[model samples]
Target: MSDAQTQKVLDHIDADFDNSLQRLFALLRIKSISADPAFAGDCKAAADHLAGDIASLGFDARVRPTAGHPAVVAKSNGKGNGGGARPHVLFYGHYDVQPVDPLNLWHRPPFEPVVTDHADGRKIIVARGAEDDKGQLMTFIEACRAWKSATGSLPLDITFLIEGEEEVGSKNFAPFLAANKDELKADYALVCDTGMWDPNTPAITTSLRGLVYDEVRIKAARRDLHSGLFGGAARNPIRVLTYILGGLFDENGHITIPGFYDGVKDLPPDILAQWKKLNLTPETFLKPVGLSIPAGEKGRLLIEQVSSRPTCSINGIVGGYTGEGSKTVIPAEASAKISFRLVEGQDPAKIRKAFRDYVTARIPGDCKVEFGDHSMAPAIALPWDMKALSAAKKALTEEWGREAVLFGSGGSIPVVADFKKTLGLESLLVGFGLDDDNIHSPNEKYDLKSFHKGIRSWARILAELAALPR
Candidate 1:
């Protein structure tokens, strides 16, 4: 691709930005809340609307049915330069928004998107799905539209996969992917569901922590007992549960489970050096949360503690309680929900087994223990030297006039793992969201600049990817 052609696409994006915002507003107006059964029609409407919009760009777009809300699949004509294959990418996004609960808190209707001035003087587009995904996804679509209008063709083969069940756990989406794996094949996947380092800085999420959510129930007695009558003789399940949980971590904040770190590896020297320069301190990362200490494994960077290192957290615990400040009873059963944030090289199943074994070994002889599984997913880490990653990073850096930060996120996006496992494709995660976007909350907004510049960024990325050797 010629630089002149790329410049034309970027120029078109700048000129047509108003129309881009309008299109995003049209999408944001659809109350496609996947979690509520009452909004099922809205979800289908979103799918159909997106399919038609994408089809306007000459793609073979169609709304396909899933077990739940439908999915939009659109593919380019696949005519490569000189009849040779080019890099093909499957762009992924969601059309669903979280339920707008507590409607009284919103300044305007959650479905009514508008461009407004932020308190910080930045132009923001406020709506329920503004930043979470509607705005973010439209950035890529608008970029494609610009390229198509400017050059009459896309720079490479493309497939669009927009789903409507992300907010809900995507339970059926995975099966949809499995059933259509052949038709959805691509060289790589592009996901816009993440955030940048900061409003001024660009970022590519190179790693995502996996999850192991489990619940443990301990029962020491069949019936509740009075504290006064059995306080000394009865084996309290709550006491047993807390005692075992207390030993799972050491003073240094490292998990004490055996073989928990079997496959864990340290970051590369170059990446570590870059992270050191970023200088993520507790004051900047934790102070806002009313915390002042780095509470992960000792001797690790605060960034590493949250992103790269594996961790175990007790999400919730419930046990015997006194009601009305009068009744004191040792409940027959006590339960706790625990979760583990895993990193690359750590297996979720093994971690889950190790944790269960650790708790089982420490249980009192008379107490009975039962474990319930909630969710488990392995961690994902992209190769540091991936060519597409380098290309996209260069494009973002140019767009933002600052070096893009390749960072690891502490949370998980299961679809990225599914792309690798099911389609044999790695994902390149890039987005223009800020830390305070208030996604999944009231009054969610997307920066107007992020919307416009994000289109320009993707246009440049497409050009850079096309220039690579086929």
Candidate 2:
């Protein structure tokens, strides 16, 4: 774990990354799309390949079956210099890639991997799962390989619990963890699905917003009506739905839901000052999206607008209408898909109820309302006082040659909360995904630099974690 020993491993990483890229290419070519049943065998192949690759580094590795695809688990003792003491780290990543749709957008077959230059002159490796997972997961494994090759053994207790079903919402991962709680238990979990703040700025994701996805349908007049016959007498459910959704946010762009802010607290002054130093503003955040407004709670910073405040959004809506030009028809029903980004301590069930109640209260007599469930998960804000995080921050800073910035991302992993609840483990998210990775999109790519540096970064992290005074 000393600098001299760490240097030898790092040098090995720099020398061996070409081989790492080849390994990752092999993985990326596997077509492990877990959401579709047609790719089941491919998912199993990816799992087995990863398990076998991991076994080559001397861990006890296996590809175990779940109700879904399968999960790869590998374990090694974290005995520093044979001291028999250190933190046991459980690393999590997904081996499956998102389904590649709109295939026409890709320059090559989505499963055919190649390193090509981006339009901007940067070298990027293209494939379906390059950045989403295969690349990200292999960074960690390659780091371990370097450590094993250079130092003869790993520096700390480590286990890899990579699964094939993350693209499908980890439907079977929780049950798998619950079933094998004892074997998978570890001191901390390391997740590589998030990203850096920017290419040069290292980031540690501190908070992830929760989600409540709901669909509401309103029935009126029981059947489609002719506008000429029922124009003024009957209420148009589409109009009513618009008013209801439009009212969720008001003049200053705050959610009008009662008690929405009940659990929200302002950031501390020191943190606010730090955020100010980062210079994250509406212009920088919005310009890329073709917007320039702080469309959330008034007086709060743009960072808070995204990371802290609860938000309401209508994802989609539909009602009866003509397919072509003019069919003046009144719809029997109108429906909209609504989702809320929840903050820490906001109960998903309570928010879901409050939303339904708001709709019910606003509905007129003789109108029937029904709801459909999409998904729900509460926000997660990891504890900062842990020694592992402290060491990790320092090590990442050393690797990037700059201070690592802790951030509050506006998305949720869902499985992080599940890991904590089911295995009593805390997770540290460190990743190399950038805003332009085009994850879950056609022509997805992972920067060659991200892949190379990501492996070296994990090398530094592993050595630094081994040095922690446990």
TM-score leader: 1
Question: 133 in model 2: Cα distance from truth in Å?
Answer: 0.5
What are the TM-scores, per candidate, against the unseen true structure? 0.98, 0.96
lDDT of 1 by residue, 1-470 (tens): 89899999999998898999999999999999999999999999999999999999999898999999999999886331123478788899999999998899999999999999999899999999999899999999999999999999999888999999999988988899999998888778999999889889999999999999999999988899999999999999989999999998999998999999999999999999999999899999999999998888899999999889999999999987745666788889999999999999999999999999999889877799999979988899999999999999999999999999999999999999998889888999999999999998999999999999999999999998887775
The global Cα lDDT (0 to 1) of model 2 is 0.86
Model 1, TM vs. native: 0.98
Clashing pairs in 2: 78-156, 78-157
User: Which lDDT values do the candidates have, in the order given?
Assistant: 0.92, 0.86
Residue-by-residue lDDT tens digits, candidate 2, 274-384: 777888887788998899877777888888778767788899999988488878988999999999999887999989988898888898876888999889998888775
Model 2 TM-score relative to the real fold: 0.96
Error of 1 at 57 (Å): 0.3
Superposed model 1: Cα runs more than 4 Å off: 78-84
